[model samples]
Target: MLPRPSRLTLPSIARWARLNGSSSRAASGGVTLLPTQEPTPEANATLTEEEFSSMIIHGRSIYPPLYHPRTHSVPVAQLQFRAYQHQFLDLYMHFVGHAAAALGIPISRPVYLPTQRSLWTVPRGPFVHKKSQENFERKVHKRAIKAWDADPEVVDRWVRYITRHAMPGVGLRVTQWKRAPLGIGQQMVDSAVGQTRLGSGAVKVKALAEKIVQQELLVEENADTATR
Candidate 1:
């Protein structure tokens, strides 16, 4: 079956109501009877003809427009201000990342935010085994290269460049990530950082490596029991 017509937008509904000399509410419920149009037999199936006619008349009584009136206009100046704020925050985060990389410090270490009176630390979890760790790192490398396939670098070069530049830059700037555009900034940084809990891909692989050793120990114990 064909889809029913979508509800008209507020502007269209208002225009139709005005042209018909009826309130918007009325325009919604009032169906105009064309010259050859007859009430459907189904209308009388539920009630007597007179009763059906009355029901038709009642259904035609359009309700008032459910117009949501905004109290104040959004100032264009405020919007422009917000845009500028976003740009500044983005640049600042970039600068932070570059600085952190130069210092050779892990960005995830709890750094005291003097102004905020709190320390900021990145998230840390999602441990796996050593064999799993190698697979995980390989997967990350493949995915990252594929994602940036449009860029002007081969996979090895891209990985090297990211290790020397992008990763550290991202780690450094994360402290300021929250100040950037909430939606866009968070997504970009998260993509760069992998999971927020673990600082970077390297950390995630290390955690997975530890789990793999534990699994090996369990397998050795099971083998000894079977031999005995």
Candidate 2:
């Protein structure tokens, strides 16, 4: 008779079974946190101590240390998108790609830098797993209350999101503007108008900012020639 499957062996078998069972369900590819193949000597070349230390501390991709230096050679401008909008970030990334395509900009080697943003992110909910509907609702209410009060967790998430997406785009957009100001300004203006804002007088400021962005009119060096 075959031996019974012990608990130790059961988990492995169960996991394998689940993976094989779901293999045909859909083709959602997985991300390998660890590299499958060893890095080549070129890729693994010794970075300076500062580079190695900083990269490890910040949880950055070690493979591409060339991005920052490259930015200097290619003009990079800084931009800030002040708010708590992850959805906007996703949409803006897509918009940037589409705009890049239209303007014949090369995006094959684009790098995203998020270390220089100034917003914070709060947790969406609790730490429970496979929670019931009631529990989920309670968690959401708690989070919502905390976020309303400007909870530290909420602030952290917002800061992280902006840091990662906005910084890189600042440079990218500035370069694009220099190449095609009229087109880029119009795009920015449309984006600013569609964006959500809060508080008294916020709407007016948003509109004004949109106009300035759309017209590329920051300094009034040629005020007489421009329409306000």
Candidate 3:
């Protein structure tokens, strides 16, 4: 049987209202259709027409785009996308993976994070009856993609392109890590000493900070090694 269509988005909800009689209980779903066209249906006896157009599907499908292997192994940046509807989030994420592949960017595997859920309870009726309480829940879906060994400029361009063509109801967050040269703190410490006779306490503090930074770099290297 073919996969069921998603009705989480506003347009899909609108389509559902149009297809199913609005007088039914499902009429609560709004009606909003997009300009894009759906694929033509196939001839199959096992699958009914209605199920092909609409039905309940658990663990929706996620089609990831291709990635071109590159020599760059360090993770330069990451992208986090979220939406109330998983369908929209996954669709846009798929598009981003493909766009990056087309540009020859080396991206890591797509990461699916846990869904965040919020709940509320209130009295169903005017009377404050404990037995007549109402409950409501809202869920936010999240997904992330990380690019490795790609040029910072290329990553910036990809981010801009995605922002310009972002879909409705989805939010994007970007984070980047800058690589620093080794032993760069020595130059700063020397310059400070030349400018003024710094006390031993200040120099000791600077050395301690530099040691912490070096330890962090080592931890990152260990983590990268483990992933490989």
Candidate 4:
């Protein structure tokens, strides 16, 4: 007779059953088993100091340094953003400031203007129920951003960027003060005359005016000759 197989304990049988079930589950593509060992110090030490120091998270460098340059000026233009919701307006302003800083623009602290409030009262019921009415109020929030000693082209690009990605329910307005050199009027006139084209009809009208003036002058000359 063959020797009886060694009897397995209940705990051993249960453990064996669990191992078989896990293996089957893994083979069936239901789950995967991963190693639980942590990275060893030797593996970590393989990385150079610079390589480890330059690591980035979410596309931003870790512990980036900031550079501040001394300046002595204010911006020539002011960008103002307004919205009925103060929270959104403030959030967008912070975003703008961040963008400006990234672009190396010297920005000043945001100036907050007085909030504008308007109230309206309307009847809640029929016209006969004049005593029953409801009141509604709205407030407008405004923020002003100033940049100092920034290039106009750069400022324009910044404005375009902000406008293109402007948040919903927010309105943007730009105010620029430009200094004109002497003889600006003459320069403008010269530019208009040089660049503008007169239509055929306009040319004809101008010729007709000159012809009329010439005819009037000739008539006066003929009258004076006749009198002589």
Candidate 5:
């Protein structure tokens, strides 16, 4: 079967309602229908037929627009979901897409991975009845969602939201990439030096190094004096 048609936006729906003159005063207050002239019988019939056909073909429902990743070079978080049921996986992915949009995170289209199938066979009765066997198979469905140009905190929240409301039988895995400045290591070391825990250890190491250097210098001076 062909995939369901894309959903119509709110404005489109309101415009259609206005054109059909089915809009109520409370619902369409201040919103005006086009042409202001009465639509002819033939035109109205054709429009109604077309709208009915569209509703039937499109399943008579609407959804939010799909989000596109904002940046390709920036770091991103990849969320992978796995489930045994394909329908549930698709529904969960749609929910995730909506959530991502709500969080203002740019996301790419869900990439459907190849289905994995495994089969097992076991004897129905005893080993003597090996010829009579039962066969069982399992299929795993997978989908990948990539979100880009998202703040780290926002990504964390998104993950937490999904985790909190996760559906049963769905498995989620998240991989995040963090991009840091070139001198981050030095910055981390410098920052660690002033910390309560790392600072004491660093100070102790520095003192030990200085003491070793001083002892080596005295040993060299004594050798030089003996030579003199």
Candidate 6:
């Protein structure tokens, strides 16, 4: 049997119906739109973490996602979601956090960034009242979720899964850091010349302060002995 569609899918299905000029009836070829199923309050309230996770995997959960405890604190990736509505954005991010946790990937508490507002004024007026113009404003809410101490492959899978089941009206952006090579001096050291990357410029620098200090002290001692 086919899986039941979630509440989030209702809006899009209705939109398609309208676009196909089918309002009180099914679309062309008897393509009937399935009614969205919303869980009752009792069921919603009694949802366990496992139940919620299953529903969320199908994009059908009503309650907010439960966050898992962080296992590792090292930040590996960050996810940011932007949407005009804060409720859906927050819900979607929490969903991602919960899924990552299921994969044993630690996640940080979401960071609530400032809402960005944009206002536009046009020459046209409301209802052809050209004498007076109106101003319209839009606010986009942003939230950031970070993955901590997670392997790159795990993070990638998490992202891929979330992308496949993306929530409507939400925009997702991901930022990930490249892993550094293992062991000491493996990242930027040249074994032959003993040089390392210094700053962002082309200037070459060596960290030999201790050796230089010892050489200067020995030179001073030699000078004193020669004077003696």
- Best candidate, lDDT: 5
In candidate 4, what are the lDDT values of residues 1-228, reduced to their tens digit?
A: 123222222223323334465775578686433333443444434444333323321222222222224286755678888899998998788667656656666776678989889999999888789889999999999989777777778788878898898999999999875556899999888777757644345788799999999999999999999999
lDDT, candidate 5, 110-192, per-residue tens:
89899999999988998789799999999999999888898889999989998898988899999998778799999888787
| lDDT for position 37 in model 2 | 45
TM-score of each: 0.15, 0.19, 0.54, 0.52, 0.59, 0.52
For residues 1-228, what per-residue lDDT tens digits would candidate 2 score against the true structure?
Answer: 134333333333333333454453344454213323433444323343233323222222212322112222333232333223444444454444333332222333333334333334445556763242232221100000001122234334433453466533222222112334568888877677667444446878989889988676545546756764
lDDT of 1 at 66: 19
Give all candidate RMSDs, comma-separated.
29.2, 24.6, 21.5, 18.4, 9.0, 13.3
Residue pairs with clashing backbones, model 1: 25-63, 26-62, 123-197, 124-197, 128-208, 129-208, 129-212, 130-212
Candidate no. 3 TM-score:
0.54
Give the per-residue lDDT of model 6 (tens digit) for 8-94: 443344344345445434443554454456424443344444433433233344434445565646788889899998889877876
Q: Give the total clashing residue pairs for model 3.
A: 2
RMSD of 2: 24.6
How are the candidates ranked when ordered by TM-score, highest leading? Answer: 5, 3, 4, 6, 2, 1
State each model's CA lDDT, in order: 0.33, 0.36, 0.71, 0.66, 0.72, 0.68
* Candidate 1 lDDT, 1-228, residue by residue in tens: 123222322223323333453553465576542323433434334343222212223222132211122233221110000112333434433333333333222222122222212234433434443233221111111000011111222223323443464322222211011123459977887777765555646777897999999999999999999999
Model 6 lDDT, residue 88, Cα? 93
Instruction: Quote the lDDT for 144 in model 2.
Output: 7
Candidate 4 residues lying further than 4 Å off, grouped into runs, are 1-70, 178-228
The per-residue C-alpha lDDT of model 6 at residue 205 equals: 26
How much is the lDDT of residue 142 in candidate 1?
9
Look at candidate 4 and give me any clashing residue pairs: none
Q: Name model 5 segments beyond 4 Å from true.
A: 1-9, 12-64, 181-183, 189-228
